[model samples]
Target: MNALKGQTLEIVQEEFANKILQIQGVGGFILVRNNGQLLASKTDMTTDPQTLAAMMILSSQDCKTLQSTMGFSRYHYLMVTQEKIGKLY
Candidate 1:
């Protein structure tokens, strides 16, 4: 299938983020490619979206590698929590 590009992709991204933001307690939304490119993000958080995307993508890869080495299946979700900060998913 042909992937969206240019203005078309931007519209879709905005629509998706708007829909998600409509849900209660939804503070942010971000979409990043496997290569660590920031496609779209709508966030009110202090952390930079680009930095967060890169870190999350890299950590996800590491987690997958660790899981495979342990002979485990893929995880449905990953969450990280810090007492001084907060939770990340």
Candidate 2:
């Protein structure tokens, strides 16, 4: 597949972030590599994007492990929710 870079990547990320922000409860949007590199973000949250990416990478691994142990199909998405901040998808 072709990869996006430079200004093109930024524009795409910005467009995607805009769409995500249109959701009723979304406060932020981030794009991260599987290795925890931050590609783009649109957030007002106090946490650093790099930190969130690293944490999310770890959490996703755990989720995959749980899925395997339970004999579940591969997941298409994951969401984590906190009482105060609501959900992250």
Candidate 3:
């Protein structure tokens, strides 16, 4: 009895690239909607837009997996933030 989680999912997604090179770090973070859709993400690749699209799919899959594992009744949104990141130097 397999569950149909992402089968009937609708997502309104968006992607963002935070060029915080002046601040620090290289790789950014990813965000998604509650319905397993891309909300926003950051990248610096010429073709990162496309890659991020794919990454969203993977992220959704991973989230769904976790939900199934933990028996989460509903799938919610994913929030990724980098407001307060610390360094160990």
Predicted structure with the largest TM-score when compared to the true one: 1
Pitting candidate 1 against candidate 3, the one with the higher lDDT is 1
lDDT of each: 0.80, 0.79, 0.50
Model 1, span 1-89: residue lDDT tens: 12366557667777777988899987777778889989888877678899989988988898899898998888887787867547777
Candidate 3 local lDDT, 1-89, one digit each (tens): 12245442222222113433334654655454545555455544444544556656776688889989998866566544434433211
**How are the candidates ranked when ordered by TM-score, highest leading?**
1, 2, 3
Model 3 Cα shift for residue 67 (angstroms)? 0.8
Q: Name the regions of candidate 1 deviating beyond 4 angstroms.
A: 1-7, 83-85
What's the TM-score of every candidate structure? Answer: 0.79, 0.70, 0.37
Task: Give the lDDT of residue 64 in candidate 1.
Answer: 91
Candidate 1's TM-score reads 0.79
Clash numbers, per candidate: 0, 0, 3
Please estimate how well model 1 matches the true structure, expressed as its whole-model Cα lDDT. Answer: 0.80
Q: Which lDDT tens digits does candidate 2 get at residues 21-63?
A: 8999777887888788888888887778888798789988988
- Regions of candidate 2 where Cα sits further than 4 Å from its true position: 1-7, 76-86
Could you tell me how far off, in angstroms, the CA of residue 49 lies in candidate 3 after the best superposition?
1.4
